[model samples]
Target: MATIGIVDTTFARFDMGSVALDEINKNASARTVRITVPGIKDLPVASKKLLEEQGCDIVIALGMPGSAEKDKMCANQASQGLIQAQLMTNKHIIEVFVHEDEAANEKELAQLMENRAREHAVNVVKLLYKPKKLIKEAGTGQRQGFEDVGPLGM
Candidate 1:
């Protein structure tokens, strides 16, 4: 079983992410994947706690183009911070980029996001690549201790 955490910048994005994740979880192979969507934030503290408290096996930071453009680096930065935090606590992390504007329809977008998440899960489980740690300890400025447990393979 995999406990998954999802964070997005807006309600629409969150809804989309939730729907997509839900679909993924419905699959027989993903039946054990529990997902939570804790909408976006400027800081990672709250979001981090939610995931940690849930004992998430993997955290997926979902971002859309519009939201990503707002801070220019919001998606990238948040993903990095959350990944670092989750890793420090020994959880896996995956950054999922959903191209909403480019999507032909809502269904398509949701499907795309679902596919992306599935792919990410697969990579993490396969130990193919480790996501970079993006946050630094408050005072130490040192790499926190966390294993890059690969994504949950589909």
Candidate 2:
């Protein structure tokens, strides 16, 4: 089973981070991917600890627009913190930008955020498992078959 640590910078509004997590968790293949949602403070440390303790294979960091500015600063700070955690723990990190600003096109922003998160997850899985050879070598002892079949038996 794979575990994932979820860090949401925007705890108040319906941020893209949680939505992306929901999408990931909804997949049957993600059934064993346990997710933990921790508070913003000490997020880097907490996420690293969760990865170590829970044996999480990946860490997902979610960012949202802040009350001030375009929330870019907050995102940058959060991303930096997550990067530090990744460097220290050597854990795979997926930084997702969630849009919650009403000034922008909310629907378009949401779609873009969701797409980015999905792509990040795919990339993380590929990097961790080396899927290209695995796909070709599956059932040949070179690669382990899917432990938990994804939806549609991906």
Candidate 3:
């Protein structure tokens, strides 16, 4: 069975990692390894370790950015690092980040986190076991947290 890695942040208000794990279990038979770090900046290293040292085929990096300027900058830096890590390892790291400001209230934030994590979990499964599924989705303007914008007829 393929091994999947999940790297999440303790700073997040919600438990996106658990939501992803549950979704992955429901969809595929892959083994999962999860690593929890202190913040978004820590995700790159943990994800790299999971792929390079833990025999993971693919990784899911989940983070939550707060509604602040510094938080947004930090999230951007983390994203660049994740991209670099993917390039270094020649593997895919499916990034799932939900900004706290995206939602109006706690309930909305919770739902956003769950939706994004659950959607990306399925993406991880597709990358491992059903790549063609993604091909069919290309340019479909699919959004994770809210409704998909749908493909603008090209």
Candidate 4:
């Protein structure tokens, strides 16, 4: 059985860690362990390293950066760190983040975060258990949270 690790940031209200675990359990037969950090900037590197050391086959990282440019900068830094962690461990880390301003309101933002987390959890399940299906589901030009956004009025 595969073991999945979940790392979530607490700066946002959404409980991405719980949602991810639920989604993973529903779609796959893997076990999950979760850890929640204080903020988005704290998520990527240490979480991945700790989970890898714990023998996790896959890691799911969740964070919510604020609307400020500083938050964006921090998120970018976190991403770079995650990339390095992936290289060092040769393990997959699924980064799932929903910005505070991704939506027009708090409710919309929560929905977006939930969607992103659940979708990525499906990705996590597919990565280890069903690689072929994942390949077929690829090739989309949509942004991170755009896949399930439905029709947008431009």
lDDT of 3 by residue, 24-132 (tens): 9999999999999999999999999999999999999999999999999999999999999999999999999999899999999999999999999999999999999
Ranking by lDDT: 3, 4, 2, 1
Off by over 4 Å in 2: 9-12, 15-42, 99-103, 131-154
Residue-by-residue lDDT tens digits, candidate 2, 6-117: 5554353445455556656654254223343543444566568767876777776655545466455665666688788889888777666553553367565556566656
Q: 1 or 4: which has the higher lDDT? A: 4
| Sort order, TM-score high to low | 3, 4, 2, 1
**Candidate 1 vs 3: which has more TM-score:** 3
The clash tally of candidate 4 reads: 0
Per-candidate TM-scores read 0.51, 0.61, 0.98, 0.89
lDDT of 1 by residue, 1-154 (tens): 5555555555445354554466445542432233344443432554466466766555555555543466446556666776677677776555656655646777776666656655554444433223332222223332111223544456
Best by lDDT: 3
Clash pairs, model 1 backbone: 8-40, 87-146, 121-151, 121-152, 122-153, 124-150, 124-151, 125-150, 125-151
Judged by whole-model lDDT over C-alpha atoms, candidate 4 comes out at 0.83
Compared with the true structure, what per-residue lDDT tens digits does model 4 show for residues 43-152? 76656766667788989999998899998999899888888788888888888878888899988888898888988898888899999986775654435555544334
Clashing pairs in 3: none
Off by over 4 Å in 4: 140-144, 147-154
Model 1 misplacement above 4 A: 9-14, 28-39, 67-70, 99-111, 121-154
